[model samples]
Target chain A: MTYCVGIEVDEGLVFAADTRTNASLDDVRVYRKLHVFEYPGQAVFAVMSAGNLATTQLALARIQRDVDDAAPRNLRTFRHLFEVAEYIGQVLVSSQVDTAGRPEFEGISTQATLILGGQVAGERPGMYMVYPLGNAIASSPETPYLQVGESKYGKPILDRIIRADTRLEDAARTALVSLDSTIRSNLSVGMPIDLALIRRDDLRITERMRLDADTPLYSDIHANWSRKLTEAVHTLPRFPWELPQD
Target chain B: MTYCVGIEVDEGLVFAADTRTNASLDDVRVYRKLHVFEYPGQAVFAVMSAGNLATTQLALARIQRDVDDAAPRNLRTFRHLFEVAEYIGQVLVSSQVDTAGRPEFEGISTQATLILGGQVAGERPGMYMVYPLGNAIASSPETPYLQVGESKYGKPILDRIIRADTRLEDAARTALVSLDSTIRSNLSVGMPIDLALIRRDDLRITERMRLDADTPLYSDIHANWSRKLTEAVHTLPRFPWELPQD
Candidate 1:
C-alpha cells in the first residue's frame, strides 16, 4: 500500500509520496517511489507510483531504457503531457502483464498505479492519474489534483486546500499535509516523503527533495498541523451545555 | 457502505452512524444504522451496524425476538457487556449463515459488522466491535473507540481528538466531525446522522437525536468545521520564500 498525490496549480505542479514498501509486515523495505526525468529545456516529468514495487521498477526501467535506446515511442518522444501519460500508462500495464497470473505469482497483485505530471517545452504543465489498466485522466480546473493508492485518508485535506490559484509553496505544503494525514491513519504509508516541484514554463524540474520524519521543515509541518487541527476542533461551537452562561 | 463509531469516554459512551444504504449507486436509500436497547435501571445497549442491511435487520429481529420470548440467553440475560457483544456477534454470523452462499445471491456478501456498547448493572460502561466472524474485541485505554465500514477517511479526527478522559459531548462532536469527513470523501457514506449518548451509570440512553444536514447544531458544526479547518491549514508555518523579508 502507498499514498501519492500530484497537484497542478497555476504556479506549477507538486508531487508528494511516501517511501515505505512491504511484501508483508516482516518484509518491509524503504524504497523511493518518486522518479523524475529532467530534460532541462526540453521537458521534465515526475512519476510517483503505488502497488507492486517490482512492477513499478519494471515500468520505470523500461521507460529509462526506451529513452536510452531512443525507441520509436519513448518518454522523450512525446510532444504533449497527456501523450507522456498515455505512454507511461502503457508501460505500467505491460509491467503487470509480465507477471500477473503466472502460476507462481497467482495470489499477488502485480498491478500498479501512477501519478504522472510535467510540462513539455511548448505546452502547459498538467497532471494525470494513470490507472493500472492503462487508462488515464488529466486533472482539470474543477479538479486540480490526482492521487493513487490509499487515497481516501489524505483526500479531505487536498479537497479543502488545493485550488487552481493556490501558490506553488502552498500547494506543496498541502500535498505534504495530505501525505501526513495518510501516514498517520494508515500503517502501510510512512516517511521519508519524496516531493518534487515543477515550475510552469520552466521546462525543467525546479525542486526535488526527500523529507524524513526528523527533517526540520517536515517535522515543523507535522507538529504544527496537528496542533492547529486540534485547536480547530476545540474552537468548534460548543454544545449547549459546554457554552459559558451569559 | 456505512460509517459508524462507538466511543467510550470517562463521562460515558457515544455512538454515531450515518443513514445511507445502497445496493449500487443508482439504488440508494436511507436507513437508520443506530439501534438502542435500553433496560432502564438495569442495562443500556446501543448497536450500530455496517454491511449487509438484510443481514443486520435479520440479526436485529432475532435479538428482538429472543428478548420478546425471554429466552435462556437473551440480551437481558447477559451479565457482562462483552457477553452481550458476543451474543450479538453470534447473531450476526447466524444472520449471514441463514442466507449466505445460497444460489441466487452468488456474489453478494451477507456479512455484517457491529459496534455494541453499554453499561451493565454493576460493571463499568464499555464498548465492543463485533466482527463478521463472530469474534469481538473491547475498546481499551489505548483505543477508546471502535469504527466500522468506510472508516479511514473519518479516522484522523478520532485519532487526534478522542481519549479515555474526553468529555462525552466532545466525543460525540468528534464522532460527528469524523463522520462528516467520511461523507465528504466517500459516496458510500452519507447523512442524516444518528447520535446516541449514554451517561455513566444512567442505566439508560441519556439522549438520542437524528441530525440532518439542515439540523441547527449539525449545520453549525458542518459550517464551522469547514471554515476552521481551512483556517488551520492556512495557519501552518510558511516556507522560507513565503516568509516576509526584513
Candidate 2:
C-alpha cells in the first residue's frame, strides 16, 4: 500500500508520497512512488502513484519511452496539464489490460491510479487524479487537493486545512502532517517520503526532497504535530460535567 | 452506515453512537444505534450497532423478548460481562443467519456488528466488539477503545488521546469528538448522537445524553475543536524555506 497526496494552492502545487511497498508481511520494500518529468522551463510534471507496483512501473516506462522516441503524443507533447493526465490514464488502462490478459496474472489486479500535478508554460498550475479506467478529473478550487491509497486516516486533516487560497508552504506542511498521521496509524505507509513542490508558472520543480523518519525536518514536524494534537485534545472544552456542578 | 465507539478506561466505560441510517440516498432516516439494558444495581449494558439495520433491530428485539420472558439466559442472567457479549454475539449471528436464509433476502448482506459495554454486579466493567461471526474481542488496557462502521476518520484522535487511566468524563468527551470527526468526514454518520457512560462498580448508567447538532454542548465542542485545530496547525513549526531562508 502507498499514501500519496497532491495539493494545488494559489502559490503552487505540492506532492507528497510514502515509499513503502509490500506484497506481503515479509516482502516489504521501499520504492519511490513519486515520479517527476521535467523539460526545464518548458513544463514539469509530478506523477504520484498507488496500487499494483508493476502496472505503475509499466505505465511510467511507456510514458518515458514515448518521450524518448519523440512519439506523436506524449507528456512532452501535451499543451495542458489535463492532456498529460489523460495520456497517463490511457497508459494505466493499457498496462492493466495487458497484464490482466496474461494467463499467469488472471486473479491479480493490475490497476493503478495516479495524481498528476504540474504546469505547462503560459498555463495555470493544476492537479488531476487519473483513474485506472482511463479518465481523469481536476481538483476543484473548493477541494483543491487529491489523494490515493490509505487516504481515510489522513483525510480529516486535509478536509479541514486545504483550500484554493492556502499558501503553498502551508499546503506542503499540511501534506507532510497528513502523511505523518497515516504512517503513525497504519504500518503499510512508511518513510522515507518523497516531496515535490512546483511554484506556479515556474515550469520547473522548485523543492524536491526525500525525507526519512530520522530526517530533522520530518522528525521535528512529526514530533511537534503529535504533541500539538495531544495538547489540542487536552484543551478541548471540558464536558459540562467536568465544569463544577453549577 | 453508522459510526459507534466504545471506550473502556480504569474509571469505567463510555459509549457514543450517531443516529443515521439509510437504505439508499433517498431513503435516509434517523434511527438510534445505542440501546441500553439496565437492571439498575444489578447490571447494565449499552449495545451499539452498525450494519444491516433490520438485522440489528431483530437482534435487539430478541434480546428484549428474552429478558421480558425471564429466559434461562439473558442480559439479566449473565454472570460476567463477557457472557453477555457472548449472548449478544450469538443473537447477532442467529439474526443474520435467519435473515440471510430467507428467499427474499438473497444477494443482500444481513450482517450486523456490535459493541457491548457494561458490568454485572461483583465483576469489572468491560467492553467487547462482537463480530458478525459470533466471536468477540475485549478492549484491552493497551487499546482501550472499540469502533464500528466508518471508523477510520475518527481513529487518529482516539489513538492519540485514549489511555487506560483516562477519566470517564474525558473518555466520554473524547468519544464525542471522535464521533464528530466521523460525522464531518462521512455523510452516512450524522447528528443526534446517543451517549452513555457507566461508572465502575456503579452497576448502573451514570450519565446518558442524546445530543443533536443544535445541542449547546455538542455545538460548542464542535466550534471550539475546529478553532483549536486551526490554531494548532498555525502554531506547528514553520518549514525551513518559510523561516527567512537563513
Candidate 3:
C-alpha cells in the first residue's frame, strides 16, 4: 500500500509519495515510488506509481529503455505533454501485461496507476493521472489536484484547501501536511517521502527533497497539526445536548 | 454510502451517523440511519447503520418488532450489551442474506455493518462493531473507536486525538469533526446527523441530538474545521524546495 499526491497550482506543481511497500503486515519493506526523468533545463517528468511493485518497476524501466534506445517512438521525444502521457499509458499497460505472465504476479492485483506531471519545452506545465488500462485524464482548473493510492484518508484536506492559484511553496506545504495526515492514520502509508516541485513554463525540475519520520519540518508540522485540530475542536461551542455538564 | 462513528471514553460513549442514502448518484436521498431503543432508566441502545439501507432498516425493524412482541427473546429482554450486539448482528445478516436473494440485489454487494453501543442494566457501558457475518468486536482501551462506511476520510484526526480517557463531550466534539471531514470528502455521506450519548454506568441515554445541514452548530463546526486546517497548514514551515525565483 502507498499514498501519492500531485497538485497542479498557479505557482507550479507539487508531487509527494510515501516509500513504504508491504505484501502484508509481516512483510513490510521500503521502496522509492517516485521516479524522475529529467534533462535538467530542458524537460523533467516525474511519475509516482502504486500497485504491484514489479509491474510498476517494469513499466518505468520499459519507458526508460524506450527513451534510451533512441527509439523513434518514446515519451522523451514526444511533441507535447499529452503525447508523453499517451506514451506512458501505452507502455504501462504493455509492461503490466508482460509482467502478469510471470509467476510473481499470481493472484496479486496487477493493476497500477501513475501520476505523470512535469514541464516540457514550449508547453504549459501539465498533470495527468494514468489509469491501469492505459487511459489518462489531465487535471483541470476545477480539479487542480490528483491523488493515487490510499487517497481517501488524506483527501478532505486537499479538497478544502487546494486551488489552482495556490503558490508552489504553499502547495508543497499543503501536500506535506496532507501526507502527514495519511501517515498518521494508516500504517500502510509509512514514509520516507519523495517530494518534487516544477515551475510553470520552466521546462525543468526545480526542487526535489526527501522527508523521513525524523525530518524536522515534517515532525513539527505533524505534531502541531494534531495539537491545533484538538484546540479547534475544544473551541467549538459545546453541543446543546451536553451543555449542562459544561 | 454512509459514515458513522462510535466512541467509548471514560465518561461514556458517543455515537453519530449521517443520514444520506443512495443506490447511485442520481438516486440519492436522505434517510435516518440512527435507531434508538430505550427502556427508560433500565437500558438504552443506539445503533448506527451503514451499507445497504434496506438491510439496516429491516434489521432495526425486526429488533423493534421482537421487543414489542412481549416475547422472552428480544432486545428489551437482553441481559447485557454484548447480547444486544449479538442479536443485532444476527438480524442484520439475516436481513442482508434475505435481500441478497432478491433479484434487485443480484448485482450488488451484500455488505452491511453496524455500530451498537450503550448501556444495559447490569454491565458497564459498551460499544461494538457488528459485522454482516453475525460477528462483532468491542471497543477497548487501546482502540476506543469504531467507524463504518466511507470511514477513511474522517479517520486521521480521530487517530491522532481520540483516546479511551477522553471526556464524553470531547468525544462527541471529535465525532462531529470526523463526520464533517467525511461529508466534505464523500458525496455519499451527507447531512442530517443523528448523535446519541450514554453516560458511564447510567444504563440510559443521557443526551441525543439530530443535526441538519442548516443547524448552526453543524455549519459552524464544518466551517471552523476547514478554516482551522487551512490555517494550520499555513503555519507549517515551507518545504525547503529551492526552486527558481519567479
Candidate 4:
C-alpha cells in the first residue's frame, strides 16, 4: 500500500509520497515511489505511484527507455502535462497487461494508479490523477489537489487547509501533515517520505527531500501537529451540561 | 450513507450519528439513525446503524416488537451486553435475508452494519460492532471506540484524542469532531446529529441531543474547531528554507 498526493496551488505545485512497500505482512521493504523526470529549466515532472510495485517499476523503466531511445512520443517531447499523464497511463496499463494474461496470476491485481504533477515551458503548473484504466483527470481551481492510495485518513486536513492561492511552502507543509496523519493511522503507509516542490513558471523542481522517521523536520511537524490538534479539541465549546448554571 | 460512532472511556460511553440519508445525489433526506432502548435504572442501549435503511428499520422494528409481544428472547431479557449485540446481529442478518431470498431484489443490497453500546445492570459498560454476518466484536482498552459508515475521514481525530482514560465529555467532543469531518468530506453524511451519553453504572442516558445546523452549541463547536485548527497549522515550525538565512 502507498499514499501519494499532488497539490496545484496558484503559486506552485507540491508532491509527496510514502516509501513503504509491502507484498505481505512479513515482506515489508522501503522503495521509492516518487519518480522524477526533469529537464532543469525547461520542464520537470514528478510521478508518484501506488499499487503493484512491479507494474510501476516496469512503467518507470519504459518511460526512461522511451526517453533514452528518443521515441517519437516520450515525456521529453510532450507539449502539455496531461499528454505526459496519458503516455504514463498507457505505459502503466501495458505493464499490468503483461502479468494479467497468465491464468496462474489471475488472483493478483497488477493495477497501478499514479499522480502526475508538472509544468512545461508554455503550459501552466497542474496535477492529474491517472487511473489504472488509462484515464486521467486534471485538478481544477475548486479541487486543487489529487490523491492516490490510503487517501481517506489524510483527506480531512487537506480539505480544510488547501486552496488555490495557498502559499507554496504552506501547501508543502500541509502535504506533510496529511501524510503524517495517514502514517500514524495506517501501518501500510510509513516513513521516509518523498517530498518535492515546483514553483509555478520555474519549469523545474526547485527543491526535494526524503524525510524518514528520525528526520528532525518531519518529527517536529508530526509532534507539533498532534499537540496542536489535541489543543484545538480541548478549546472547543463545552456541552451545556458541562457548564455551570447561571 | 451515514456516520455513527460509539466510544467507550473509563468514565462511560458516547454515541453520535448523522441524520442524512441519500438514495441518490438528488434523492437526499434526513432520517434518524440512533435508536435508544432504555429501561432507566435497569439497563440502557443505543443502537446506531448504517446501510440499507429498510433493513435497519426492519431490524429496529423487530427489537421493539419483540419487547412489546414479550418474546422468549428480547433485549429486556439479555443478561450481558454481548448477548444484546448477538441478538442484534441475528436480527440484522435476518432482516437482510428477507430481501436476499427474493429474485427481484437481487441487484440491490439489503445489508446493514451496526454499533451497539450499552450496559446491563450487572455487566460492565461496553460497546460492540455487530457485523452483517451475525458476528460481533467488543471494544477493548486498546481500541475504545467503534464506528460504522463513512468512518475513515473521522478516524484520525479518534485515534489522536480517545483513550481508555479520556474524560467522557472529551470523548463526546472528539466524536463530534469526527462526525463534522465526515460530514464535510462526504455528501452522503450530513446534519442534525443525534448524540447520547451513558455514564458508567448510571443505567440510563444522562444527556441526549439533536443538534441541527442552527444549534448554538454544535455551531460553536464546529466554528471554533475550524478556527483553532487553522491557528495550529500556522504555528507549526516553518520549513528550513522558509526561515531567514543568516
Candidate 5:
C-alpha cells in the first residue's frame, strides 16, 4: 500500500509520496516512490507511483532508457503534459504485460498507477493520474488534485483545504498534511516522504526534498496539526443536553 | 453501503449510524440502522447493523420474536453483555443460513455485521462488534471505538480524539463528526443518522435521537467543524522555504 498526492494550484504543482513498500509485514522495504525528470529550464516531470513495485520500477527504468536514447516517444519529446501522461500509462501497461507473461507470475497482479505532474516548455503546468489500464485523467479547477493509492483517509483534508488559487507552498503543506493523515491512519503508508514543487512557467523543479519521520519541518507540521485538530474538536458546539460551562 | 460507529468511554456508550441503504444508486432507500432493546430500569441494548439488509432485518425480527416468546437464548435472558453479543451473532448466523439455503440465493451472500453496545445489570457498560462469521470483539480501553461499513473516511478523527476517558456527550459528538466526514467523502453513506447514548449503570438509554442533514444541531456541528478545520489548517507551521508574510 502507498499514499501519494499531487495538487495543481494557480501558482504551480505540488507532489508528495510516502516511501514504504511491503510484500508482507515482515518483508517491508523503503523505496523512493517519487521520480523527477528534469531538462533544466526546458521541461520537468515528476512521476509518483503506487501499486506493484516491480511494474513501476520496470516502467521507470524503460522511461529513463528512452530519455537516454532520446527516443521519439519519450517524456522529453512530449509537447503536452497529457501526452506524457499517455506515454506513462502505455509504459505501465507494457511493463505489466511483460511481467505477467511469466508462468510463475500466475494469479499475481502487475498493475501500477501513477501521478504525473509537470510542464512542457510551451504548455501550462498540469497534473494527471495515469491508470494501470493505459488511460489517464487530468485534474480540474473544481478538483485541483490527483491521488493514487490509499487515497481516502487523506482526502477530507484535501477536499476542505485545496483550491485552484491556493499558493504553491500552501498546497505543498496541505499535501504533506494529507499524507500525514493517511500515514497515521494506515500502517502500510510510512515516512521518508518525497515532496516536489514546481512554480508555474518555471519549466524547472523549484523545491524537491525527502522528509523522514524525524525531519524537523515534517515533525513540526505533524505535531502542530495534531494539536490544532484536537483543539478544533474541543471547540465544536456542545450537545444540546449538555449544561452550559460555568 | 452503511456507516456505523460505537464508542465506549468512561461516562458510557455512544452509538451512531447513517440511514441510507441502496441495492444500487437508483434503488436507494432510507432505513434505520440503529435499534434498541430495552427492559426499562433493568437493561438496554443498542444494536447497529451494516451489510445484508435482509439478513439484518431477519436477525432483528427473530430477536423480537425471541423476546416475545421469552426464549431461553433470547437477549432478555442474557446475564452478561458478551452473552447478548453472542446471542446476536448466533441469530445473525442463523438468519444468513436460513436465507442462503434457498436455491434462488445460491450465489448471494446473506452476511450482516453488527455492533452491540449496552449494559447488563451486574456488569460495566460494554460494546462488541459482531462479525459476519459469528465471532465478536469488544472495545478495549486502548481502542474505545468500533466501526463498520465505509469506515475509513471517518476513522482519522476517531483515532486522534477518542479515548477511554472521553465524556459521553463528547463521544457522541465525535461519532456524529465521524459520520459527517464519511457522508461527505462517500455517496453510499448519507443523511438522517441515528444516535443513541447510554449512561453507565443507568440500565436504560439516556438519549436516542435521529439527526437528519438539516437538523439545526447537526448542521451547526457540520458548519463549525468545517470552519474550525480550515482555521486549523491556517495555523499549521509554514514550510521553511516559504516567504514570510507581511
Candidate 6:
C-alpha cells in the first residue's frame, strides 16, 4: 500500500509520496517513489508512483530509455503537460501489456498509478493523475487536487483544506499534513518522503528534497500538529452533564 | 456504509454510530445501528454494528428473540461485558448462517463486526470487538479505541488522542469529531446518529440520544470542529522560501 498526493495550486504544484513498499509484513523495502526529470530552466517534471513497484520501475525505465533515444514522443519535447502525461501513461500501459505476455504476470494486478505534474517552457504548470490503462485526467478548478494509492484515510483532510485558489505553500503543507495523517494510522505507508514543488510558468523545480525521520521541518510540523489537535479537542466544551448525586 | 466508534476511557464507555444504509446508491435507507439492552439500575449494554445491514439486523433480531424466549441468556444476568459480547457474537454468527440460507442473502458478505462495551457490576468498564466468526477480542490499555464500518477516514484522530486514561467526556468528544470527519467524506455514511454514554459502576446509561441534522449540539460541534481545523492549518508556520527568479 502507498499514499501519494499531487496538487496544482495557484502559486505552483506540490508533489509528495511515502517510500515504503512491502510484498508482505516481513518482506518490506524502501523505494523512492518520486522521480524527477529536470532539464535545467527548460522543464521540470516530477512523477510519483504507487502500486506494483516492478511495473512502475519498468514503466519509468522505458520512459527514460525513450528520452535517452531523443525520440519525438519523449518527455523532453512534449509541448504540453497533457502530452507528457499521455506519453507516460502510454508507455506504462504498453510495458504492462508486454509483461502480461509472460506467464509470470498471471494473477498479478500489473498496474501502477502515477501522478504527473510539472511545467514545460510554453505551457502553464499542470498536474495529472495517470492511470495504468493508458489514460489520464488533469486537475482543474473543481478538482485542484489529486491523490492515488491508500487515499481514503487521508482524503477527509484534503477535502476540508484544499481549494482552487489555495497558495502553493499552504497546499504543500496541507499535502504533508494529509500524508502525516495517513502514515500515522496505516502501517503500510512509512517515512523518507519525497516532496517537490514547481512554481507556475517557472519551468524549474522550486523545491525538491527527500524528507526522512530526521527532517527538521517535518518533525516540527508533526509535533505541532499533534499538540494543536490535542489542545483543540480539550478546549471543546465538555458534554452538558446534569450533575449526578455524589 | 457506517462509521461507529467505541471507547473505553476513565470516565466510562462511549459508543456512537451513524445511521445510513444502502443496497446501492439509489436504494438508500436510514436504520439505527446502535442497539441497547438495559436492565435499569442493574446493567446497561450497547451494541454498534458495521457491515452488511441484513446480517446485522438478523443478528440483532436473534439476540432480542433469545432474551424474549422463556429460557433466555438474558443480558440482565450476564456477569461481565465480555459474556455479553460473546453472547452477541454467537448469536450474530448463528443468525448470519441461518439467514445465508435464504434467497435474499445471496452475494452478501454476511460478515458483521460489532463493538460491545459497557459496565456490568463487579467488572471494570470493558469493550470488545467481535468478529463474524463468533470470536472476539477485548480492548486493552494499549488499544483503548475500537471502530467499525468505514472506519479508516476517522482513525488517525483516534490513534493520536485515545489512551486508557483519557477522560470519558473527552473520548466521547473525540469519537464525535471522528464521526464528523467520516460523514463529510463518505456518501454512504450520514446523519441522525445514535450516541450512548455509560458510567462506571452505576451500571446505567448516563446519556443516550439520537442526534439528527437539527440537533443544535451536534451541529455546533461539527461546525466548530471544521472551523477549528481550518484555523489550526492556517496557524501552522508556512514553508519559508526565498522566491526563485522565473
* Per-prediction TM-score: 0.91, 0.93, 0.88, 0.91, 0.93, 0.91
Candidate 4 stretches with Cα past 4 Å from truth are: A93-105, B70-72, B98-107, B221-224
DockQ of each: 0.54, 0.55, 0.63, 0.61, 0.59, 0.60
What's the CA error at residue B238 for candidate 5, in Å? 2.0
Which candidate's TM-score is highest? 5
The stretch of ten residues in a row with the least summed lDDT in candidate 3 chain A is: A97-106
CA deviation > 4 Å runs, candidate 2: A99-104, B99-104, B244-246
Please give, as one word, the docking class of candidate 4: medium
Per-residue alpha-carbon lDDT of candidate 6 for residues A43-117, written as tens digits (9 for 90 to 100): 899999988898899999988888899987888887788889888988888766455557777776778889999
How far in Å is the alpha carbon of B10 misplaced in model 6? 0.8
- How much DockQ does model 1 earn? 0.54
Which candidate has the highest DockQ of all? 3
Give lDDT: candidate 5, residue B16: 96
What tens-digit string does per-residue lDDT give for candidate 1 at A64-95? 99999999998788899888988998889889
> To one decimal, what is the Cα RMSD in angstroms of model 5 from the true structure?
2.5
- Per-residue accuracy of model 3 over B50-148 as CA lDDT, tens digit each: 887777778888988898897677887888888888888888888885545678777787678999988887778889999989899999988899999
Between candidates 1 and 6, the one scoring higher on DockQ is 6
Which structure among the candidates has the greatest lDDT? 4
lDDT of 4 by residue, A1-246 (tens): 899999989999999999999988889999999988889777899999999998889999999999999999998898888888889889988888656568998879988998999999988888899999999999999899999999999998888878787888888888988898899888999989999999988887888999887787788886666667777777777889889999
State in Å the error of residue A40, model 6: 3.8
lDDT of 3 by residue, A103-220 (tens): 7766767779999998888778889999999999999999999999889888877877787777788788888888988887788998898998988876677888899878988888
The interface RMSD values of the models, given in order, are: 1.8, 1.8, 1.6, 1.4, 1.6, 1.6
lDDT of 1 at B86: 82
Model 5 ranges off by over 4 Å: A98-104, A243-246, B98-106, B243-246
lDDT of 6 at A71: 87
Better of 3 and 4 by lDDT: 4
Cα deviation at A138, candidate 3, in Å, is 1.0
Q: Is the docking of candidate 3 incorrect, acceptable, medium or high quality?
A: medium
The fraction of reference interface contacts (C-alpha pairs within 8 A across chains A and B) present in each candidate is 0.49, 0.48, 0.70, 0.63, 0.51, 0.48
Which lDDT value does model 6 have at B23? 82
